[model samples]
Target: MAQGTLEVVLINAKGLENTDFLNNMDPYVIVCYGSQKRKSSIASGQGSEPEWNETFTFDVNLGDLVSPLRFWTAIVVQRMTVLEKLCNIPLESVMEEGKVPAAPYNVVKDQEFRGQIKVSLSFTHKTHRHGHGMAVQEESYGGWKQSSTY
Candidate 1:
């Protein structure tokens, strides 16, 4: 099973408590790792990654989450970003091109001020061969769509 944690570190700023802005900001950086059979029968795409690690940072204004509540929201985003990246459907072109998904889980605020939010992400990949223990059919399109959980 994949395991990880998301954290949002809050900093001190002036007059910055906007829920809309906090929610709008992109948060979450996912890191995944797993091993799978080299051959795949299900059209879900490749099922093996010797190892993986990646980091995705948000472009939102850090000073916006000046309030305690907004700080918490930022933390949530940091965590969710990881899930999105891990389970995000592999681009057909990219996958076909032999580009493995990068596990992104390390994020740091670039701002030079105190009270800034810092998010730390980490996880392991636990993948399996397609239809290894069961039977599955490939789609006519030969590609898999995004799934919430695998």
Candidate 2:
């Protein structure tokens, strides 16, 4: 059987208001996994120039997100819209618990932006149900330990 992967793309960001101030925000991508006891994989990207716009794209295994369709839909509709309206998305954009919003990007209505950037991510999915929650283990070279076991 062929493996399934989720492809995420960051569309254009537009500023709702006009301003001369430079919005130095970058679009970020995140993958959420599990539910009731969820976890997330967050990545940061650069922003567009003061006069140019950019897009970000990423791919992930469908199984990575507990409810891939539901979660992604919410991100596309709610968070993205809000971020565009705000004109700037901070690196510390992710909120507390499972309340993290979509990655934000810098945009301006009239001001020229020569500082835009793009990012991409890709990962495979591995489905393993652990009932209560899922656990991830990572091994590092230094000491062959799972120290940063996020």
lDDT (10s digit) by residue, model 1, range 1-150 = 211112222211221222233343333222222211111111111111111122332221112121111221121333442222112222233222323333232222343222222223222222334544642322212343333334
lDDT of 1 at 108: 22
Cα-based lDDT at residue 141, candidate 1: 27
What CA RMSD would candidate 2 show? 14.3
Model 1: residues with Cα > 4 Å off, grouped in runs:
1-26, 31-87, 100-150
Q: 1-150, model 2: which lDDT tens digit per residue?
A: 112233333433333221212443333323232232111222222232212222222232222223422122011222342223223332111111212334434433457452222322233333433336864332223324334322
lDDT of all predictions: 0.24, 0.28
lDDT of 2 at 133: 83
- How many clashing pairs does model 1 include? 17
Best candidate, lDDT-wise?
2
Q: What are the clash counts of all predictions, listed in order?
A: 17, 17
